[model samples]
Structure formats: C-alpha cells, structure tokens
Target: MKNSGEELHFRMDLGDSIEAREQSMISFYKRQRVDWTAPLTCTLEGDAAIGDGVKRHCLSSVMSKLQFGFEWKIGAGKTLLFEGEKDHLVPAASQVFVDSDLFVVAGRMIGHSFLHNGPCLTGLSQAVIHVLGGGMPEMASIDIEDCCDTDVREAVELLKGSAELTADQKRSIQSLASGWDLPGVTEENRRWLTEKILFHAVLSRSKGQVKQLRKGLKETQVLDLVTKRPDTLPLLFPRSCAVLYSPQLLLERIIWPAESDSGDETDDTSLEEKCRISGFLREYIENASSQCLQELLKFWHGWEVPPKELYVEVVHGLMPRSSTCMETLRLPSHYISYDAFREALNAAISSVPTGFGLV
Candidate 1:
C-alpha cells in the first residue's frame, strides 16, 4: 500500500523505527533499477573512405565499429532497460582487451631483450630486464655496454689470432673494429694500441727477420764482414733491411703461421721433439738434484760420458713421442685441475732456465 501527504507507509513489526523504515525504503529504491547513463559512442563524421594507403585503411577499419547506445527505465515499477545500438560496446570491450594484451606482449618483449646475448640486442635487452626486475635501466645499460664492449674486443683479438677460427673471425673483426671507431670507445682507449706499439713489435721481430735474411749468409762471410765493417755495420743491419722488409706482411705471417704452411713437417717434428726433450731434462734434474751439489757430485765420479746425454735420455723417457704417451708415463697434462697440479706446474715452470732447455 502507498501512503500520501509527503510520507510513506509500510507494514512493519512494533519494534520498527523511522530510521529502519527509511533504510528499507532506500534499499528498495536502489534495487528498483533507476535509469542511468551508458557509455557514449565516439563519433566519426563524413563518408568512410578506403584506399590502398595503410593509414587511411586502418582509420576506416576502426571507424566501422563506432555505434551509439543508451540506458532507460521501463514499467510502473521502473526496471532497467538497455536501448539504442549495443554493437559498439562489443568493439569497445574488445579494444580494451586487445590493448591490455598488447601491453603484456610489449612487457614480455622488453624482458626478452635483456636476456638475449646477441651483439645488437644484448645491451637493450639487459636494460629492459633490469628495469622490469626493479633496477635502474639507464645505469644497467651503461654498465652492460661497457662490459660487453670489453669482452667483445678481447674476443675479437683472440679470434683474430686463433688457429681454429673460421669466416666468423673476419666478420667479428670487421664488426668490433667498427665498434672501436664508434664514440663509445672513447679517446683514452683509442691510445691503448697505437701505431707505435705496432712499430715497436715490428722492430723487436726485426732480429728474427735479420736471422732469416742472414740464412744465405751462413756459407758466405758477408754477415761477419758486415759486422766487422764500421760504416757498413749500421746500414747492413735493420736500417738497411727495413727498406726491403714489409713489417705488416711479416707480422701477419708471425701472427697467423697456419696461413703460410699447412703441411710444414719440419715445424711439427723439430718443435715437438725439442719441447719433449726439454721437459724430460727438467723432470730428471728436479728429481735427481740435491741441496748439496758437492755431495751429488760424488755420485757422478764414476760416470764415463757427459751427464748431458743422461739428461737428454731422461727427458726422452718422460715425454716420449706424443703428449698422450707422455701422459701415460705420468707427465703433466694440458688440463690441470687442482692445487697439487698447480704446484707441479710451478715446479715444471721453474725447473728449466731460458736457453738451457733449447735443443
């Protein structure tokens, strides 16, 4: 039943108060579903134009989804009703969903950028990861780039000198050299390896080249005669040789020996034999030598031949033929694993003095 005269009536228990009745009425009104505003459609004016142009095509495509709608109340009790076109709401909701999905995808892409190890993306990738992981992106990028550049340069140099390098080395060298020319390398690092360093290394290797130049002079007395001639001495030396010598070509040869001789048998045999003999002698001396040389000398009294031959034999026994055979006899392996190995390595390193080990 409805009450008039600016008051409302309702059936209630005796305990019901005005406040309770008002609250109940308010709750009822809220549940009655009064008309409320719906989302308005974004309008697109003029005829829809489609063209081969990508931008116009996209605009026309998006505008096709634009449609308007409203909300209203109906019946004596005032029930909610949805009115006008509702098609646009689907597109609007879809757009929101697509945007959210895109955001997520973008976030993932940024994350992946950091984890990647490629030359181009690694820096940006790490930066994105750091930011996403709650670190400062800018600072991380700087640090990462610095470390990457250093590593890249070192790797490039190593690969440039490596025996096993392929076409990758050439490509890496080109790439890194280009990077070195970039502003990021800085002027200070630019001076690290200069033309002077190259020149000095060339000069040092000049002696080896002079030896090669004097190879034919072994039978001829030209080298000795030149050494004796005061005026010719300086001229006959590196200063004269430099005119004919190509330091670049020489250095390239020394740096990459593989390019010169793939089947150089003398290089393999002589170097390997000498190394083995030197190693064996060192091991023998280390095992045999006592703190008191005079006491050790007493044992050598009965020895007929020179002790050098015995040393040579011992070297041969320790490092026979190949490194694998040497290993079978318990000679040091290339791959060391422990402190004891390191100590043994130290012993090996110190046992032979320079020139003494030469075959």
Candidate 2:
C-alpha cells in the first residue's frame, strides 16, 4: 500500500482481503472477484436499500468476519493495483469506535476496519450506530464525554416531565441528579448512570411497584440506597418490575410467565418464579414496574373483567384483609379468598368499555 497526494494506492497481494466502496474502485488487475456489499448488511438483518446504485445483500452467516459496505476477494498469487480517494485509516489496535451514530455518516463512510463489528447501521437516519469504545484515538476523544453528557442531560429532562412523578418524588429525583457530578464522572460510568436514571423515573408510577417505592423511601437504609445507589432501586421493587427496566427483556413479547404455553417446564417455571403472582394482592405488587399497565388493563377489560370493578377489586386487595378475632373459633378466618378476589377483579376490568384507564 502507498499514498501520494489526494489519491490512495494499494496492492491486493495474493490471498488478501481488501474492502472498498462500490464506486470507489478506480483500476484493478489480476483475476479477483470484487463484491459490492450493502452498508453494514453483514451484521444487520432485514433488507434495506442504502442509497442509489447500492446492491441489496443479506447479513453474512460468518460470525468473526466483518461485512463492509463492499468487499473484494483476492485470489492467491494474484497482484492487483487499486486507486481511490484519500482515506484516514483508524487503527483498530489503538483506537475504539464509540457511538457510531455520531461518527458514521451515510455516503461519507468509505470503509471500516475488520477489527470490530459493533451494532449494524442502516440507510435509515434513525438507525443505531454501534459506537466503538476502548482507547481514545487521535482527534476522537474530545467529543465522547460531551456526547455522553448531552444524552444524560436529555434523559434527565424527560424524567423531570414524567407524569408518574409526585411532587415529593420529583424533588427526590432532582436531589439525586444534583448530587451526581456529571462533568467529573467517567465517560463509561455516565452511560450507566443515564440508563439507571431513565429506567427508574419511567417505572416510578408503575402500578404494582409504586407502593414498594414509597415503602423504600420511608426506610433510612432504603433512602440511603435510593440516593447513593440509584441503580439498585429497581431491585427493591418486584422482579416483574425490575425486569421491565432491562432493555433486552422488554424487547421480547409482553406476557406474564404463567400465560405462556411453551411447554418447557424448566423455562416456564423459571419465568414464573421471576414473575410470580399467585393472587390479586401479589399481582398488584408484582406488576408495579410495568410501563404498559394501561395496555394490560385494556386486555383485561376486553376478555377478563369490567374495568371499574377491576379497579375496585385492586383497591380492596391492596388493603389488609386478614384480622385476628380475639376469641374466634380458635382459627383465623379469611374475609376474601385469593380466587374470589382475582375473579371479581377480572370481571370488573372486562365490563368497562373504556376501562378505568382515564380514571
């Protein structure tokens, strides 16, 4: 490989793999097949046309190899000369890609190195760019901290306007955010913090989980946990609530574990344990972290219950139903059975056409 002025000169020596843009190939020699590939198609699934004159290709099956927007397979003992525009080669060993969305611009990206394949980028402007992150390469380090800060600040702004937050809840969140030394924090740590803040704020108003959050706020240890280690706040809620914060889990189909018919006892049992709700009281508590409570209510209204009655049952279930009679038949008697409460709740939600969503 050689460089002269604005032109780049390279030799595809025997058995070499050279990737260049589809239209960038100026001249080539020897019998080597030059394959044109779609931008980031190797890692991304689904068909998306990148731009004019770009070929449509599927993501390659190979795991370790990177599918550049285009590729050239040079045969053994073949020597080829290629010339194109000047390009800056970002050394993979020293530098890491961070937030490709900010750096990789369509039509501007000639080629990327084979050293890493992060998230696949698409022709769509909103496509996620897999940001490379490892070492600070020359001229690339200045924007990382700034970008992280901006993203975090934007998420915080969203949190402040969230409808679920009570007056006190908003003040509590603000106190934590104010204490966070955003500028002084490391780039990676900032990303983590940003995720935690957004997840907690969004789930703050989740139905089944709100009571737990209030409970935690009252305990000195839990309050300390909330202020100093906000990341663990989701844990104080039920697993059903905590799992909602996980991006990976939420991406899957939304359904309680007991609702699945996969027939895999082990997996089903595991999911049930993670999201166990045996009765109305437990169900209300467990589902507190769900973001789709309204949607879930709609489902219940359509098939399970009338919304107004479901709402009433939920209110009664939350209160303590069991009381010890000072001289009862020497055994505790229940005011409401779990089955009756669940059935009444379901009937209530199903009867309301609009449900209690607005109420």
Candidate 3:
C-alpha cells in the first residue's frame, strides 16, 4: 500500500492476488477508487489460500503440537495485503510472534511460521499477517444489502411510492436521490436519507399534526432498537435520536476491560472504587422522585454538559444580570456536595449585589 496525500490509497489489480491479512477486502473492483476517496483499488479473483476456518484448526493443531501454555482464541477478521502484481507475487514480511500476541483473523489460521529460538512457540518467519490488535476499538457495521445498488434503487422506489410525504418533502427526496450518484447507498447516505425524510415530514406539518408523526417515528425507532439491537444508535437527529439505553452496559464497557481473564487472586482495585461510588449514588437516589430522571432527560435533551471552565464562565457571566438570578435558577436538588459546584455557587452568590459586604 502506498500513501496518497492524507490517506493511504492502494489499488488491487484485477485478477492479481494480493494477500491481505484476512477478510480486509470489503469488495474488490478492478483498479477503482474505494467509495470516492481511496486512491488505489485492487481486485483479487480467487479465494484465500488458507481461508478463515481452516486456518483456525491448523493454528490450533500447531499450537497444541508446540504445547504453548496459554488458551488462545482468534478474533473475527483481519486482512494482510502483500505486495505483488497478478503474475509475480510473494508472501508478506513475517516476524516472530508470541502465542498470546498472535491470533487468527477470519477462520483461517494459516501463516508462514516456524518454531524458532528459545520459546518453542509458533513464530512467523516471513509473511504478512494481520489480526485484531490489543485494546478495544470502536466498530460500526453496515449490511451488505445497504451497499448494493439494487437496494438503493428499491429504497428510492419505495420512497417515491410513499404517500405520507408532503409535496415539498417529496421534492426534497427527489433532489437528494438525484444527487446520490454513487453505485450503492453507503450507511452514512442511508442514515442521511432516513433522517432527511423524517425531518422534512416533521417540519412540513403543523404543530398538532407533527405530534402523531413524531410519536410514530419514536415507536419505529424503539422497535428498531429492540429488534435489530445496535450497540449505539446513529446520530440521525440531534435531539430526537435514541442512544444506547442501558447505563449498566456503558459502565461495564467503559470500566471493565474486555477479553481478559479474572482470577480470584487478581483484584480490580478500580472496580472496587467504582462500586463504592455507585453504591453511594444508588442510595442517594433511592428516595429521589421518578421525575428526577425525567428532569435530567429534559435538561440534557438539546444540550450537552459543558466543560468545567466553560460552565464556570457561563455561570459567572450570567449571575450579574439579575439580583434574584440565583432564586430564579432553582436546581432540581437545592444541595449537592461538590467542590466545583460550591465554587460556582459561591461565585454566583458573590456576584449578586448585597448590602452587606461580599463574603
């Protein structure tokens, strides 16, 4: 692969075999820009030599033969692309890899490797290899159908037949469809279309008429979330989109490391701290009204929690506007024990003119 400007762009020559890590090729075309930005595209005609499943068994057999001391599992898929044209090709560069460090991509566990030196572990002598690297990476998936031109055409036709749209909405959709010149509808484009259609329909209606439409849209969204089960919702609409609904899931994902072993002797000190904090918060909110959650949702619906400095600046700037501004701005809870909160309150209180000198 060669770097073309800001991004790496490489083309696979049609009928030329480029050995990728595994399953990295999204859809091969004969020397074409991937989407629109990729500088080079390559196409390989035949299947991988090892394939995904066969590689796994082969790797397992080799590792068992070596008696490597750790249980290993291969990740979903990774691609390693080797340098060569259709006629002349060679294996990619290979390096020695620890058993724990080396995992299979796709189903195939095939790699050009040998037992070397002291470890008596499987090692890559000379070959290009790719596998899921360490640490969690944010992932998103688009269906194969979503990328097909036929699917886009059908979706466009369905939109054309939709009778619920206003004249303006229909026109806007037509305009959007005309400009979607790409062969297939990408996930981004699909999301845009979905959002735009709803947006137009909502805006075109009067206030009362929009309510039912909004409700319907919300129901459909919830159904999609429940049925399809996305890890995270696409940010289709700024204020109206449904995000991941479970705080527990978020907490576990953010706090607890994935693909790790936990032994009785191994203590998660951070987890203990988090548990303590969570317990206190749970106890504090036990007597809180149900409306507390609703109020929080309402407050954050159209706004994000600002950074501490920005929040302090905004509070300080606004405090001087009215003598009773503090009284007017009633928090859901009148009291909270936090240093920044206290500081902001003190600043606001101090800014209000008082006959007695400022504390």
The estimated TM-scores of all candidates read 0.14, 0.17, 0.16
lDDT of 3 by residue, 154-224 (tens): 44544545345556655555665555332223434555565343322222212232232223223223323
What does each candidate score in C-alpha RMSD?
Answer: 41.2, 26.4, 25.9
How many Å off is the CA of 112 in candidate 3?
36
lDDT of 1 by residue, 261-336 (tens): 3464444434444445344434444454232221111112111111221111112122221111111112333322
Q: Residue 123's C-alpha lDDT in candidate 1?
A: 14
Candidate 2 vs. true structure, TM-score: 0.17
Q: After superposition, how far is residue 60 of candidate 2 from its true place, in Å?
A: 14
Off by over 4 Å in 3: 1-241, 244-249, 252-274, 278-359
**Per lDDT, what order, best first?**
2, 3, 1
Quote the lDDT for 232 in model 2.
39
TM-score computed on alpha carbons, candidate 3: 0.16
Clashes of 2: 22
**Between prediction 1 and prediction 2, which has the larger TM-score?**
2
Candidate 2 residue lDDT tens string, 265-350: 43323333233233443454344344343323333222111122332111113322211111000111122455554554444433
Winner on TM-score between 1 and 3 is 3
